[model samples]
Target: MGQVHVVGPNRALLISGSGASGKQPRVIVGGRAFVPWIFQRADFLSLELRTIIIESKKSATAYGVMVSVTGVCQVKISGFRESNSGSGSPKLEKDVHAILLAGQHFIGAKKEEIEHSVASTMEGHQRSILGTLTVEELYKDRSAFSARVRELANEDLRLMGMELVSYTIATISDEEGYLDALGISQTESVKKVAQIGESVNRNEGRQRNAEEELKAQLKINEAKKKIEQSNRDVEVMQAKLKEEVNVANARADAAKLFEEAKLKQSIVEEETKQDVVRATVQVDVESEKVRRRRMELDASVRAQAEAELFKKLKEAEGIREFASAEAHRIKLIGEAEAEALRKKELVEVDMLRLKADAYKEYGQAALATRMIETMPEVARAIAAPLAKTEKIVFLGASGGSSSGPSALLSEVTKGAHIVNEGLQAITGVSLGEILKGDSSLNGLERLAMPIALNAVVANQGH
Candidate 1:
């Protein structure tokens, strides 16, 4: 019959059914089941095996100190499948049979006997090994002790179909407080060494800081010297610049004198040429004078005609200028009248448009409310100038209708009324109509009062 079995990653399969050929099967399976028969973990497993050596029976070290040792070991079925030589075929001995199970499970009566036997065998060897070594040797070189135990126990474990993978000495302790006392002395020595090292490091750090400061001071001194050298260099450069400027100025003056002298020479040469030209024209001038006198008599008559004609031309020119000026003046007057009429029409059109817009936006009452809104600000503005009045003398307060700050208030009201009249004259907004709160603007002032009060408070906060 075909059977499937599951095996773990740490396990190997061994099957022995009817007509089995070998004692331990060569087949090993891992991962998923594939017609598996028997399986068990073949990899290493650890056992925490410890033993106590009584104080009277404690294993003595080389120095005569007795210590109890606790150890653990890792054991596994050996990788070597066969025990005999190549010529002989291997069979499962009684010990191997006791270690391995028929059903492939590791836990059974025979398995326990084999494990106990291996553990006791290891403990016996551990005690024998500790008896040869001291506590000092055990602590300093625990690997050698564990290695020796494993070496000795491996042979016995092999007979049981098991092998020692590793052995570890978990702890070692003495009956007396010898280890604690030894640790205290070593700790004191370490503390003294650490203190000495710390002191040496601190002194070195201070010396390094002093050296750094000295280096910084040297650099500062070098920088100061460089600054002084740069200043000296700058002074030399300035002196050189000044000398070069003086030389350039001298050359400029010399070039100017040379230019002036050359100009004077050229002027003298031009004057000489003019004198020669004048002499040449003098002879022709005498002849021209004689001929001109004879023609003068005829020219006098022509000149009289030309003067009369010129006077007539001048009279006609004056008349033409006067006529053109009158025409220009008339045209300017006509243009001025047209411009005035156009401006008047435009103003009426704008006023009508504004009124229509206002009615559309806020009903017919907006004009009155708009005027009323301006009155509060205008009143404030008129009172603004009075803010400069540190003192006011009320001459008629004793005999007049109002007195004290109330009289001052009355004066302010009069100022506001006067300003309102001026605004009415300029912008044609009637303060009287605004104050009457006519039309839909009747309760607007009450609503605006809170807005104005909030504004004043916010400004004051700022």
Candidate 2:
């Protein structure tokens, strides 16, 4: 018997040397295959995923910023098996070819050696990708960077009969604190944005609150206005009701007054009818009485008129006789009185003629005599107002020449001088000239004496 070999789900069996499908190797997966003891040899390849740690140091980025990178990668040999459908399709052929290549490259290799080789290849590709990208791209989006790195290394890995299952960046770092500064910048930016968002939200909240308050106030004002309007409507309704009540009352009163007036007019009409009947009867009775009284009055008036006519005729006769006698007596008295009056008039004419002749002959003496006769009366008349004065007041200085009786005498003298001036103005002759008996006193002096004397007598009488 030959040695028996078993293949697991995660492993592939490779048979090489003579009797192994010519120069090409036979691959077995998920089953056992027999190998002749002397002519053929068998090897196993791990088909399971292998973890590769890739670390790149001092790798330069596109911007010349040096960075360090650490990553993990899952890799495996390409697996294949005979198709159950027994079809040689292009995709199936391609899978078979890949498995053949994987067996040739990794057959009999240790897990460590495979990992090391894959890590070296991944690291080189990581560095190349790093060179093409910015440090921010490498740090911020490691997945995309890792994907790019895996895509670049996968081509080479496929040539080596391997496939990259997955690539992940475990850590990204820098020697110059570039990543730390980047993290800090991002953290601060996030904090600033958060603060700004909070402030905006707070302001919006306040604005909404203010709007709500304003709306509430507007509602309250509208409500109050409505209430006031309602009150006004109520007041108007009440006033209208009161006016209607007053109007109704006034109409009722007018109706009552109208009825009362109608009743009173009926009563007055009935009373007037009764009064007319009574007045008609009384007028007939009074007419009959008046006719009788008129007949009696006519007879009595005729008798009285006859008596009065006879008495008047008698008195007329007596009056005629007395009048004749009285006329004769009056004639005798008139003749005698006429004779006495004619004689008296003749005597008076003769006396007036003689008096006029005497006055013409002695005009100066007559004027002088008149003045002498009227001077005392004039003096007394001039002093009459002073006699009636209850008391005399002297306002002048006591010891002066104008004080006492001297002032009184001076006032009297001034009054006399005023009188003399008046006389001169009236008669064109001064009192002094008249008293000196100046020969210039013509007929004017005679006229002046009488007027002066009459004025003085009138004053004395007052």
Candidate 3:
């Protein structure tokens, strides 16, 4: 069904669908909607077209509505050419290439549109989408051009409403070396260029290797020198460090010793202080004892001195009294002796007068004497003498005395002086001259003999 060409505003695309897209809408091409006459020429359209059919739609949900849809159909020109004859030129091939390329792009776009419509309707939201073509034939070989293919896939994936979340160029090996080597084939153009570059780079690499060898040798020499210098420096530094270590060790030892010595010194000082304290305590105790003892001794000495002083004072007083008594007795004796001498001389006059009288009587009466007249006046006078008694006196006053001459004469008669005096008279001797006796005698003794002799003679004569 060939249609006549006409200039018109109602331009259209009369493209027929493939697979499940048989009912798909015809989109405008170059802003025209052209009616397709494929139904009248169904045999011609079916003969010339490659077709794929997908029967099932995807599952979708919207606002609690679950809509199950079918998958889209895909179409491509697996083979198309206006000329494959040797005489055919490149123009016809180019047109066929363009038509095939356009048809593939349309198939990819529609597939993505259907998938995005399902995704958007199911999600109940509008989202950015894209469509991309996935041509497995393009990935028949692995080469640097794969990078461009990956970029194209990623770019158009969103535009085509395709999700290229993950991408890998799984090379297909069904064509030539692609089939033999799993589609990892070398591109002929790239291989030829790489071979030429490899040859040219070989020469350049040789030149670079020569230069690098020279540089490496120089660096090796420099490294060797640096290593030798570093060894020398390490040796020097080691020697210096060894010296410092020795110094540090010596200093540490010295510090330790000094600290030890100081500790010992402190200990010694502490001990010395303890000893001093003990010594001081002992000295204080001993001093206290000595002081107490000395105090006791001093007290004792004082007591003894006081007692001796009292004793000596009493003895001195007694000696004084004894000496005074001796002096008084001596004075009394001297005074008595003096008084007796005076008394004896006075009494001796009486004795001589009486003796004179007796001698006169003896001498006269032996011849012729009157009896009455024989008593001489001298006897009478002598016998009557000493009628006043002898008295002891104290310092100008009369003191105590016993019986005077009469009692004294009685006492004298009991003494031996009478016989001695009589013997001295009869023997014609002085008594003092005869016996050399003390001439001092009691006055009573001296006077009594004469009167007794006179009385006795008178009795005999009668």
Q: List lDDT for all candidates, in order.
A: 0.54, 0.67, 0.40
State residue 405's C-alpha deviation in candidate 2, in Å.
99
Worst 10 residues of 1 by lDDT: 41-50
lDDT of 1 by residue, 120-149 (tens): 777788888887886656777889988888
| lDDT: worst 10-residue window of model 3 | 125-134
Please report the TM-score between candidate 3 and the true structure.
0.20
Q: What TM-score does candidate 1 reach?
A: 0.36
Point out where model 2 deviates above 4 Å.
21-23, 80-94, 229-462
Better by lDDT, candidate 3 or 1? 1
User: What is the descending TM-score order?
Assistant: 2, 1, 3
At residue 192, candidate 3 shows an lDDT of 76
C-alpha TM-score for every candidate: 0.36, 0.48, 0.20
* lDDT for position 392 in model 3: 21
- Judge candidate 2 at residue 319 and give its lDDT: 35
On TM-score, the candidate that comes out on top is: 2
lDDT per residue for candidate 3 within 232-277, as digits (tens), equals 9999999999999999999999999989867765565454445434
lDDT of 2 by residue, 30-115 (tens): 78888888888888877888888899998999999988889899988878434545464534322556677777777667788888
